[model samples]
Target: MRQLLKFELYKIYRQKSIYILFGVLMLIISLGLYMDRESEQANYLVYKQWEGEITADKLAYLDKEIIEIEKKMESGIETPQERLLYGISESFAYQLGNAHKHEKRIADLTAIINTDSTSYKERAAELEKNMLSKINMSKFYYDAGPAQIIDMIYTFGFVITAFLIIIGIAPILSNEYSSGMDQFLLSSKYGRSKAITSKIIASVIFTLSVITGWVALNTAVSVYTYGFHGWKAPLQSMFQHYFAPYPITLGEAYPIMISMHLLAALGFTLIVICVSAICKRGLLSLLVSGFIFGVPFAIDVVFEDLENIVWLNKLLKLSIYQCMKVKEQFVDFSTYNVFGFPVLYPVVTVLLSVITAIIFSYLTKWIMKRKQVTI
Candidate 1:
């Protein structure tokens, strides 16, 4: 079993296509980081200009500054500096409001996660304790700027990771059949159970390595360009348009994205493996898996505003696209309740990924048990 697993790993390493995918991933990361580095420093310029203007560290000073600016505007005479002050003040006010909302959202979600019992009385007691355990999240004054989180996470990370996984693992079993190696392997001792088992383990290891490489490169570059200053600040503080009430910082959000995306990638890899196991030709397996993975994205683009076709629209949220959209899903205000618990949108994706993985595990086992290699 160990030798078979090593051989599988050796085969993957020997594949030039796998090496080429790694090169492409590095190239994309290099280009993205280079392009964004110069523009990233500009956000800091504005932030520093006003940094010395205000002496206080609290949000109250910013509020007072806003009132003073409004008074000056009322006189129908304003200076450039006053306008800048107003803009900065409002930005601070927005962050303060976002932080407060996030704290409340955290408390609510905490209560939801803490309740394990189905009894109404136990749930009621926990709810009261939750209200009393409210955390005071006020001092969130940081101008670390937008982390370019979506671009790094989805465009450069998730897409590339998924493409490589499909390339690397889609041929795990199909390639054996395509090259007529399956017949010999199945006829040999320990081939039926041990060899197949080794392939499954190898597939998992290969998939995880791809995901980890993508995520690590993206994260290292992003933090290098942006710095790790606002990691503990509110997610909204970094992206003004992002108003998700998730009580989490960029620091907290980073690991969550990694975990969720990892599960999602594993789920996709397993289904592709299942397809590869079933199909006669490796190319046909790739096509079928590609179609299954792509149909949701196509629907999302073609019928994004499709309110009437709600069920069809939801198909978009159930696939790789949803996994790629880690940030949006986390912050989405949509509440899905299962047995009275308020499950977040991002969590729904995670759960679906796990469920899909389990389902395909059984399917793959059944296929292997009934395995045949036709000449």
Candidate 2:
């Protein structure tokens, strides 16, 4: 077993495919970091300028709006919850209008300073504060915090890792047939069991190494750019509320979310490798694997709004998204209630995928033993 494992590791090291995958992962991380850096710096500058302008005058104006909202609630025209909802709605609406006004105000201030203003520094400071206030308002509605940004960066990085894993393992079994080496490997004394096991171990090691590398690279870059203080934020909630109708903060759920992501990626890689082994043709394996993964996604997209149709809704709900237990974490929605219990889509998906992969691996070995190698 040790000898077999060593041979498998050596084979992986000799293969150029592993290097190619590593290069791609590095490229993706570099580009993503560069883009994020520019965006975050600009946002930070705006924030700094706004901090200087938060004064008594601005507070008084904001207090007037709050007073009006309270007065409406005290009139007994609506329930407290209803009044609170209305107030929140009104606040968002006002923010939208304020954004437009703020832009125009900045433009006018710039023109005045350029033409006749001797108080250029003071005017610039005020305008910067105004811009920053707009940024803060926007942040409330959308995820602009360091944690959210890191999450997004990590997601993209993971996607790159997935692509590499799929490509790396696509030829695991197929290349043996293509190069007429299958017979030699299978006919040896300990061939059938040992060779197959070695290949599996190699594929697993390669997949795990790639995942770890990409995650580490992304984490390092994120920390350098955004700091490392927001690690406790609930990853699941943050992802679910990414584009949700009602945004929520899951600041306390980050660890579970990260674990789920890692599990999903590992499960997905194993399934793809199993498919590659079963198909024994790189192109066909890739296509079949892609279809198996994509068909469920396409079904969800087409029938997502048919929840009113009981059977269709149930079928859609049972998709790999729900099966994986990370669907809620990865998808945006107003609310999620599944059979009176919260759906753990990521966990379920990982479990199901792993089971399926194991079954496929056994089937592949069984089929290989019975078939004649003709290359």
* TM-score for all models, in order of appearance: 0.76, 0.59
Error of 1 at 196 (Å): 1.8
Q: Backbone collision count in every prediction?
A: 0, 14
lDDT of 2 by residue, 260-313 (tens): 555555566667766766776778887876675566656666875676777866
Worst 10 residues of 2 by lDDT: 239-248
* Model 2 lDDT on a 0 to 1 scale: 0.56
Error of 2 at 64 (Å): 7.3
In candidate 2, position 100 carries an lDDT of 59
State which candidate has the highest lDDT: 1
**What is the lDDT for 131 in model 2?**
33
- Candidate RMSDs in Å, in order, are 5.7, 17.5
Query: How much is 267 displaced in model 1, in angstroms?
Result: 0.8
Quote the RMSD, in angstroms, for model 2: 17.5
**What lDDT is reached at residue 65 by model 2?**
57
